[model samples]
Target chain A: MDQRSIADVTVLSPTGRIDLDTTPPLQDCLLPLTQVASAKVVVDFAGVSYISSSGLRALMLGAKAARAAQGRLVVCCLNPAVAEIFRISRFHLVVEVQNDLAAALAALSSSAAAAYRHG
Target chain B: MTGKPIHMPRLRLVGQAAEIGPAVDTVRRFALAAGLPPESCDALALAVDEAVSNILRHAYDAPVDSAVTIDAAADGEGIEVVLADRGRPFSPLDRSPPRLEGGAADRPVGGLGIHLMRTLVDRIDYRREGDVNRLTLSKYRTAALAAGAPRGEDGADDTGA
Candidate 1:
């Protein structure tokens, strides 16, 4: 469970079980970055099969921080099971969610490029 | 020394992993009887399935001749689920938060269970006592001690992969 930066976007691709045991590692990876860079973060859930409330809180925190930095948080590529979760929680209202990784990256890249061009 | 049995709803099953589906069905019934809405029942089943999946992968490690016990209960207040296993102590909530808005390439792999748990249930408290690991999940139908859960029935079935 790690996150990598691509161009101006950060992709989080997680596998295995995302329960109480594995969530801390993901949290540790994001906390510092939210404190540093204000770049767009897009979590790709294509590979993730499951998620829990603790995991959702972490995402909320990161997205909140990114927004504070004038950046945005977007999630994409959700497996059916995981996608059902986002739908139930209505997370789309707060954070943008996409169907595929390409869409997520394209949206983030274009948004950032637009920001750069304007500001 | 045999310890006294913990009096909670228990379902014991052996054999193939698919058997877990029926077990979840039983748990869903219990939830319905306990006053949980239809939608919540479905959500509880999903949570139970995820927990059992972990037991299948980490505890018994597949095709093992051991029984998985799922304990559930409700005290006219909220729903609680306790999944116990003798496998190694693994806490899914100990990981860092993912970069939900980070670049696709920078996002790490593996580690979304805790997030799911956090998002699905109102509160999930985990503990490892002696040789047993106990994960306690609580959800309320009315007032919650923490955050507000998504609005819906208790046993809403969702079709998904």
Candidate 2:
């Protein structure tokens, strides 16, 4: 897993399968970001070939924490298989999922701008 | 219905979470070979992975090495996967489904695996014969066997989830 910051948005790139064996690292990477107030987080699943319910749980935990902190968690670049799982689990309804990394960044930026303008 | 049995290669793996990858690969290959679409194959793989993971986590009391057997057979209607484990008897279907309507924070972390299994597959059955706990998950071929064989009446109580 790799974590980088782009335009102040925390982007997490996790590779391989995110099942029971691999979710802890992802949780570790995202949960801390959620604690930061107004944190903008985007998870890139481009390299992730598969994900199970455990992975979904980890994402949910991050999303919930971020929401509580008035931040945002966005997921993007899902392979078709992972996207199918997301659709089946109705994860798209809970978390904001973008098509790719660029789109996700744009989403976060626009949302941040909106918050700033409104504030 | 062809009235002929479809045979699929059986996959045997150690009861460990790490072992779920190879098992899912085997299921994906088998599903594709059986002419299932990629979407169906993905769903089957996910369901199988969840089942195996559940067994690895909840079935055993101690870290005794045991094998989980998975058999996939195309029943001219869809695909049926039987996962048999010798660990403690537990019925995944008996677990309550997660509440999916709530907010992300309010959503329970666990129980979603069982819920996914229930939604992804058309039917599931569980039986404890002696020491083996057998779980059969079936995904119907919506296009191929639309009006063919009747669903398996295993009478496995799927109360919900």
Candidate 3:
């Protein structure tokens, strides 16, 4: 997983399969981000070819932790296969999903601005 | 249409979570060679991984080593994958799919693997014979392959009995 920070949003670009063998690393990567308050995360699935239920469970925990911390998690650029899994399991409803990175970043930026206005 | 011998492969692995990789790899290779679409191959691989993982996690509680066997065959229009385990008998089809109507904070963290398997594949059948539990997943050729061919089942049973 390659991670970079743009403004307040952390972008995680994980390549290859996110199955039983791979989800632990993904969890480690996302755990710290969800610990901080108001942390924004974007997982780019453009290079991910497949994701098993184990991966989904890890993401669910991360999303829940992030929510508890008042943070946000968004996923984007899912291939049709991965997207179908997300849709069927309703992970899309749990985590925000965008078509691409640009859209995700834009949504994050607007949400951040809204937060600033509310506070 | 040309007559070609269907490719069938049998894989056996210890019932361990780490062994799911090799099982999924074997299924993906067979699916690709059988002319399945890339997305279909990924879906099939995911289903196999979930099934094998469930066996490793839920089937055995004792220290005894167990085995999970997977048999795959293609009949020109679709592929049939059968996974058999000798551990305690449990049917994944009996579990209901998790409800998706709730928000993220209220959603449960597990139980989506079987739901994905049910939705991604064209057909799924579960049965137990004696001490073995068998789960069959079938994926039919969709837009990527020629359609409207009579479906046939290649009886390549590798239950490892």
Candidate 4:
């Protein structure tokens, strides 16, 4: 997993499978970040080939925290398998999901969008 | 449906969350060797993962002390995975489906495990025999066959992979 900041948007790129045993690191990276007030976060699943419902559970908790804090949480770049899982779970209803990282940043705020463009 | 499972060894492990990955991996390999497509193999593997996770979470108080057994068999049609645990008589299919109609705030997080198991595999059956809780998850080659087949009634013939 790699964490980076683009403008105000915190992007977390997690690789490999996110199942029962591997979800804690993802939760650790996301939960506290989403808890911050007005936080803008993007989870990139481009490198993640698979994610079980356990991973979705973690993201749901993060989404709740982000909503409570009046922040934004978006996930982007899902591979085919992961995308299928998301579709089955209907996770897009709970948290914003974008096909492009740029779109995710744009949905966060105009400033983050511009920052992504500038870089 | 009467296809005898290929001769693969059944696995018994401590009913701990950590046992999920290895068990799923074994099933994935077994499915692939049975000629299931890559995506089908992965999907079947996910169902196994969720089932074991449910057993670890809901079935046992001391997961390390209890045992979860897994077996996989595949024939020309598809694959079936059997997971049995000695914990309480927990029937996951009996739980209400996750309400996916609403947004995150009102959405429930806890129920997706069973829901995913339902969606990932073609069919899931839970039965309690004697003191054992037995859950069977099946993924059909017909599902993979249907994936590339023309869309029609035949495509929905069996459980999807």
Candidate 5:
């Protein structure tokens, strides 16, 4: 997983399969981000082609954490396979889903988007 | 779409969390060679991955020395995977589905694995044979896919081989 901060909105691009063995790192990297008040985080799945339930569970935890913290967690650029996992799990209802990074960035507070452009 | 088992590539591994990935990949390669469609293959792989994880996580007291046996066969009809573990007599099919109706905070965090294993494939069966726990997952090929030609070898990912 490669992470970078875009004007306080953290973008996480996780590559490869997110399975039982691979989910702990993701949870470690993601869970704390959602705890900050009004935190904005976007997980980019462009590099991910497959995911299992463990991964979905992590996302669920992130969503609940974000909700508790009054923050936002969005996921974008899911391939068809990964999208099917999300659909079957009904995770899209839990976390915001977007088409791409740009859309994900746009879904946050306009202040964050403005910061991205002007930074 | 239950066809007679053609050939079996039995995979036996130590029942540890790390072995789940290799087990899923082996079942996937078998499914791919069986001429399953890409979507069905992916679903089967995920189901297998979940099944193995469940066995490792729930069945064993300590999985270091235990074994999980996987026997998968792909006929022209569909794919069938039989997983056996000697750790415990747990039945995953007996569990209720995860509550998808609620918000994330209201939902439990861990039950999605069993739900995915149940919903991803067409059929799932569980049986306890004496001291062993066996779970079978089946995905039948559609009429078009069964009648169509096999996928090209180029489509196979080179990770496990």
Candidate 6:
């Protein structure tokens, strides 16, 4: 429904349709936070049942924002239907994905923290 | 308040997978009217359904009471389909692609809706117009259509009929 920030990471969990009609709220929410703080970003797709090009664009923009901020963005808890989409689009290569919230958080924290910690 | 109609196509439905058949047929008729080939027509219909189905399922949580509009027409060499609704804006195209771990057979049947739309249509434009959400999908007819491609119609697959 919305992307929320918690524990230094931004979580974007979208429910309902994610086509041309319903992508803006999530984009508006995640893009700014990723840009400003460069915090670790994890998108929970558990509730998202569909993905369209407009939805793909939103994620692309978010990934760009995370990259620009020197932060990392990841995806987790994708349903099988949604996961098929990632495979077809080859988005699996560009984004980090995990099986659940715990893994996503761990990956987000560890990878992002390591990057910042090392630099 | 202004009294102007939405200036879109007349919308009619009550929400059911049954509605998908009619909805796809209606959009296909519009596409055919605009001179699209059979294959293109079917693809467009599928694309429309994928969007509409998402609205039926995730938007309203079922196929009932939710309204969908089909305002389709020609824009130069391409056809444009406008699917408008009052659901919350939760674009799936805007999200990062998830990691897939198995084949299509092992996959679920939901998330592919948007992917199918993107694969079938040339361009997808989404915007908010007042209280409703509007999605515009465009596609150009291939050379095969200009060469007299078959004009097939989708069967009415509604179980209720």
Best by DockQ: 5
Over A1-119, each residue of candidate 4 has an lDDT whose tens digit, in order, gives 79999889999999988988889999998999999999999999888878888899999999999999999899999988888888888888988989999999888878878988998
The better candidate by DockQ, 4 or 5, is 5
lDDT per residue as tens, model 4, B1-161: 55665945898877656777877888899888888889889888888888888787778766355588898778877777888888889877667788987778999877898888877777666677788887877788875653553322223333241
Q: List model 6 lDDT by residue over B1-161, tens digit each.
A: 11222233665656555566666677878777767776677667768877877776666643446566667776446576778787777554564433334422233323555666766666666666666777777667665433342211111111121
Instruction: Give the residue spans of candidate 2 off by over 4 A.
Output: A110-119, B143-154, B157-161
Which CAPRI quality tier does the interface of model 5 achieve?
medium
Score chain A of each prediction against the true chain A by TM-score and list the results. 0.83, 0.90, 0.90, 0.95, 0.93, 0.85
How would you encode candidate 5's per-residue C-alpha lDDT over B41-155 as one tens digit per residue? Answer: 8999999998888877777776356578898877767887989889778877568787887678788888999888877877776777788887778788885653352322211
Interface RMSD of 1: 8.9
- lDDT by residue (tens digit), candidate 1, B1-161: 02232234577656345566677678778888877776676677667766775666666544645546678877656677877777678655565654444432344333444455555666666667787777766666655632454322221222110
Compose the digit string of candidate 2's lDDT tens values, residues B41-145: 888889999999888888888776666899988856778899999999888767766777756866766788988887777777888878999999887778455
| Model 1, C-alpha of B49: deviation from truth (Å) | 1.8
Give the share of true interchain contacts found in each model.
Answer: 0.07, 0.67, 0.87, 0.83, 0.78, 0.02
lDDT of each: 0.64, 0.82, 0.80, 0.83, 0.82, 0.65
What lDDT tens digits, residue by residue, belong to model 3 across residues B1-161? Answer: 12453756578776666678877988999999888888888888888888888887788776445578898888766888989888888877677778677777888888888787776676677778988898888887775442342211222223332
Worst 10 residues of 3 chain A by lDDT: A110-119
Full candidate order by DockQ, most accurate first: 5, 4, 3, 2, 1, 6
Q: Which stretches of candidate 5 lie over 4 Å from their true place?
A: A114-119, B1-4, B143-161
Considering summed lDDT, which 10 consecutive residues are worst modelled in model 6 chain B?
B150-159
Over 4 Å off in model 4, which ranges?
B144-161
Indicate the TM-score of model 3: 0.82
